[model samples]
Target: MTGLIMNERDIVVPGEKIASGMDYLPGNGTFREGEDIYSSQLGLVGVNGRFVKVIPLTGKYTPREGDIVVGKVVDVGFGMWNVDIGSAYSAILNMRETSEFIDRGADLSHYYDFNDVVIAQVTKVVRYKDVNLTMKGQGLRKVKGGKIIDVTPSKVPRIIGKQGSMIKMIKEGTGCNIVVGQNGKVWIKGERIEDEVKATEVILKIEQESHTQGLTDTIKNILEGKGK
Candidate 1:
């Protein structure tokens, strides 16, 4: 007989058995050994129709093309800036990709100085060390006067919520301009520091308790209690 050994949203460790028999199929973070399916990573269980997968609880950021990421300029070279996007490899932002006619031999640092934070889109991912980024798109620009926070990259979807409802609610409640990058970096700017702090707290709470049920209601209650 086919059966699920673990319920949906169940926390599972690596190599833990999550299902039994041939009627079930293994998805991401899972492996099939004979008739049993086991978890390949420590994460929350996700059951979608007949597919079972694990939503990782923690992991390093994996840059993908077309991902919007919040990155810091680490080094300014002849024609490009090296950005640390919370990944093992630093992404490159070429001056040509800045969407301006940059004259050759001009100081590239004038456009993007070192230590500057920017919201950029991943233009290309040739390899780990060759990730390319661009700032030509709308809403992609330098971040100023805000606090940045990091979360597990995998938990970004939960923070964004369906149709951007979760983030919209948080912004309404805290009066903060929040930007969430796919690289797990979040920037929050508010009129008051207390509002920013509250937004940060709520975001961290969602990241920690994402696997739990009734998360929407719980977050709403938290915001309401703060008179937000």
Candidate 2:
């Protein structure tokens, strides 16, 4: 008979037995050996039908093609801007990927000077290092007049919640324009600075307690209580 050795959302480390029997299959961050499934890394256990997986609790962001990310312009070079996307490998945004056309040697820094934060999409990633970014799409551009915060990349989904319900609630409660990046950067802008700070606290709370059950209801209560 198949049996779960750990509860769903349980914190597990590598080599921890998660399930027993052939009825279970291993998914991401898990491995199967001798008819048993084991956690392959430190993460929260998630079970769906017969498949068991572990969602990482902490990790660096790995840029993937088609991911929307927030980046800081670190340097301006010939026809390209080097961006730090909170990853080991910096990304390149060529002038062609920008929203406007450029003339040769036309002062690239005029477009994206150092330390400017922008929301862009990853267009290509070669060998996990050569990442290319684009800023020609909707909602992609330099973000100004907002506070940017970083969280553990693994908790991004929990911060967003299902169908963006969590983020939507936060935005409504604080009356802030918040943008969450796949690279774990969150930008919050509000008419009042207090609102921005509150939104930041809520997002950090979600990141901290993401593995807990009843998280949605809990977060909703938090927002409502704070609004009063």
Candidate 3:
């Protein structure tokens, strides 16, 4: 019989034996040497169907279609801006995609210049390895007077939680505007700097302890204590 040695979110190391025997086999992040599967990196175990994979707890961003991302303008063209999305591939924001009625003759920098941080949605994934982004939608625009934090891209969904329950709690507790990017970037802004700091701390804490159960309740207690 095949046996699984780790649970989801369990931290594992390179060359660790994940499973053994021939009735079941491992996939991605594992190499099969005869009847046993060995891990490739130090990461958390993720089981998908019969395949066991490892999600690197620490790594750079990887782009995907329809992922909401936080990015900074790096280069401004006549009708588009080049943004760094923390990926090996750079993203492009076309003039038409930035706004509904962008005048062809208007200066693109007026809308977004170099070093401007903005929240955008990935619209398309190019086959040649480039991503197209758009900013024309609700809650998508330039971010001002806030700090950005970087987290592991794979942990983003956990930080956000199912149906955004985690983020909703953080916003309600701290009264801060928090935007989570699928690319592992976060933007936080609040009326007061102290609130912003609290929000950031809460988010980082979630990122670090996402694997644990009862995270929502733990976070609520932390926020409640802040009121005292």
Off by over 4 Å in 1: 1-9, 17-38, 46-53, 127-129
Ranking of models by TM-score? 3, 1, 2
Model 2 Cα shift for residue 168 (angstroms):
0.9
List ranges where model 3 is wrong by over 4 Å.
1-9, 15-38
List residue ranges in candidate 2 displaced over 4 A.
1-10, 15-40, 45-53
Residue 43, candidate 3: C-alpha displacement in angstroms: 1.6
Identify the superior model by lDDT, candidate 1 or candidate 3.
1
RMSD of each: 2.8, 3.0, 2.7
Q: Would you give me the overall lDDT of model 2?
A: 0.92
Report lDDT (CA) for all predictions.
0.92, 0.92, 0.86
lDDT of 2 by residue, 115-154 (tens): 9999999999998799999998999999888899999988
lDDT tens per residue, model 3, 1-106: 4678777778889899887776556776777888887788778888887788888777677677878999999999878999999988779999889756788789
Question: Which residue pairs clash within candidate 2?
Answer: none
lDDT of 1 by residue, 93-196 (tens): 99899967899999988888988999999999976668999999999998888899999999999999999999999999899999999999999999999999
